[model samples]
Target: MEIYQLVFETAIEINPGAVAVGAALGIVVGVPLGAAIAKLVQKRAERGVKGTARVGRLRAKRAWDA
Candidate 1:
């Protein structure tokens, strides 16, 4: 087994602390984004249900008239 290390002063430095903070920030930002998406999906589902009910009512009325 051999380990290779590259030391470059011009390379971008990656700090573990910064990565952890970025992960935490991503979760903080994602929670509300997820909630907003869920709300939109919920509204879309409700609209679908309402549209189905309206179609059902129209069908029933047509059957009754016939």
Candidate 2:
């Protein structure tokens, strides 16, 4: 959540302009970025779900290092 919030917050800081163009640009850039993040996280979750399902496995390597 913090990461996703940071992405939008950075975009707004860069593109804080008039309503039409700023909104258009934000949508153009933000949607794909958000979707890509979502997909990557989803993939990671899926790959690690089995191995990390146990509470004792909380610090185990996930898809990022598995």
Candidate 3:
């Protein structure tokens, strides 16, 4: 049998209750994990954009004064 079929059969044969509980826990954990990762990426991008804007303003001021 293929690996997936074997795995499925084993999972069903084992404590079905445990499998259900584990799947539920995975869903709960996964949602927050995904959200946290997305938030972190967004914050990093915002910081990068702010830094670039500051540098650009400084450069423009220097060029204008010279």
Give all candidates' CA lDDT scores. Answer: 0.72, 0.75, 0.86
Write candidate 2's Cα lDDT for 1-66 as tens digits.
999779768867776665457678889999999999999879978887665457445545464376
Name every residue pair that clashes in candidate 3.
Answer: none
TM-score of model number 1: 0.50
lDDT of 3 by residue, 1-66 (tens): 699778867897987888788789999999999999999879978777657678789999999999
Question: What clash count does candidate 1 reach?
Answer: 0
> What is the model-wide C-alpha lDDT for candidate 1?
0.72
Ranked by TM-score, top first: 3, 1, 2
Off by over 4 Å in 1: 1-13, 49-66
Q: Order the candidate numbers by lDDT, best to worst.
A: 3, 2, 1
Error of 1 at 41 (Å): 0.4
What TM-score, over all chains together, does every model reach?
0.50, 0.43, 0.52
Which segments of model 3 are wrong by more than 4 Å?
Answer: 1-9, 49-66
TM-score of 2: 0.43
Q: Among all windows of ten consecutive residues in candidate 2, which has the lowest summed lDDT?
A: 55-64
